[model samples]
Target: MKTAIVGAGAMGQLFGARLQLAGTDVVFLDTNQATIDVLNARGVTLQTESRTEHTPARAARASELDETFDLFIIFTKGFHTQAAVASIAHLIGAESCGLTLQNGLGNAERLQEYFGPSKTLLGVTDFPADLSAPGMVSSNSRGKVRLGALGNVPRLPNIAQLLDSADLHAAVEQDIRIPVWEKVAFNAALNTLSAVTGLTVGGIGADPHARGLVASVLEETLAVAGRLQIDVSRQRIEAALDNAFAHHTHHKTSMLMDREAGRPTEIDTIGGAVVRLGQDNGVSTPVLATLCELVRTAARPGDNR
Candidate 1:
């Protein structure tokens, strides 16, 4: 399949390199001239815990795209979702599909708005990815992408098959809402804490005060999820949070990375979304509510967080 990776940041480079290594015709789409120049010149380097692999790559700006593609996988940050997709919507052919493995809520909705349910796929990756440098990316995504169709659209076997052929470890979920919420809740719980406290994942897990605050956020989010009947389990979110805290103690969350870079974190999409759902569901999310304000306040003015 001819695939284009929108938002070829860390995760983009990781997936793009792997797909190309596996023999798929993959190209990158990014707004950064440096990223495009680096990719077009020497391709990308993907580093893992074990070893590294280099893959030849191609890239172009969205406006420079002159052809349609079979698939577009969005890895852009939450705030850039709308504009990113809109800029590249011309590349999505009639039979083509768009998949978003992005973090936070509303991404699926955004993709659906642009591509429609029948042409949209929702996916989530557990792979921890970091863009160590402009042309270098690292990830733990050794296998498997959890994917599902949106709304009542019939499962597209071709999408999963193509990813599997590229050795991306594709697995289809009948109802992907479960994993979506699970991941969102996990991010909502700890990412904000890491950003606000200036601590690593492990530090948040170790601190009694931080852990207590995280637990409150989790409870409030789960309550809201339950009310929405999203099939999110408290036990599941707790287990995932515990697992991350224990294993990735020193790891910095995406939110913390954004905060440090003075970029807009997905604070509203992750934490603020929880608070909004809580209010709509008649559930009080005081902890999440406070987190939303604090995080927003902490964002620098020039960044438009």
Candidate 2:
């Protein structure tokens, strides 16, 4: 398949490189000139716990490409979803599928505006990727992707097959919302708390007070999910949390990374989205709401204080 990996960030490079190495034609679509140039020049370098691999890459801005794509795997931040999808409108043919494995909610809706519901795919991934440099990504081989179509589409399994061929460990889910909400709950707790307190996964788990905050956020988010009838699994989410806290102790969440770099975090889509849903469903989420505001204030640009 001719694939376009949008965003060219850490996760983007990780997936693109793997697919390219698996013999799929992969091109990276990104707005950053430095990232585009580096990808085109040095390709992508992926480092994992076992080994490191390199794959030659092609990258360009949307305006620079004229070929239609078979699939578009979106990895852009939540705030940039609309603009990013709109920029690639010319490349989305009738048969093309747009998949958003990005964190947070509402990304699939933005894609649906361009690709339509039938051609849009929504999913979640726990794959942790860190961009050490423009074309260098570090990650562990310990994550899987769960995705499904927004509307009935027979070819959805083929998309999953394509990812599996690249060893992405993907599966087409019957109800994608469940996993998506569960992931949102997990991120709303860990990501927000870590961003606000500069705590690593283990640090939060180690501190009783921080751990209490995490539990409160998780509970509030799960309540919001329950009101929506999403049936997100609390036991599964708690087990995932326990695993992360014990094993991935030194790991810094994407939100914390963005905060430390003074870049905008995905608080709006992750934490803020849950709070909005809670309010709509008459479920109070005071803890998540407060953390959302705190993350926003902490990540504001040019804050010298």
lDDT of every model, 2 decimals: 0.86, 0.91
Over 1-305, each residue of candidate 2 has an lDDT whose tens digit, in order, gives 89999999999999999899899999999999999999989999999999999999999999888889999999999989999999999998889989999999999999989988888998998888888889999998878899897688667899999998888999989999999999998999999999999999999999999989989998999888888888889899999999999998999998998889888788889999999989989999999999988888887677322
- Rate residue 88 of model 1 by lDDT: 90
The global Cα lDDT (0 to 1) of model 2 is: 0.91
TM match of model 1 to true structure:
0.95
Clashes of each: 2, 0
- Candidate 1 residue spans exceeding 4 A from truth: 141-143
Superposed model 2: Cα runs more than 4 Å off: 302-305
In candidate 1, what are the lDDT values of residues 126-182, reduced to their tens digit?
766777777788876465689997676554677888777776788889889888988
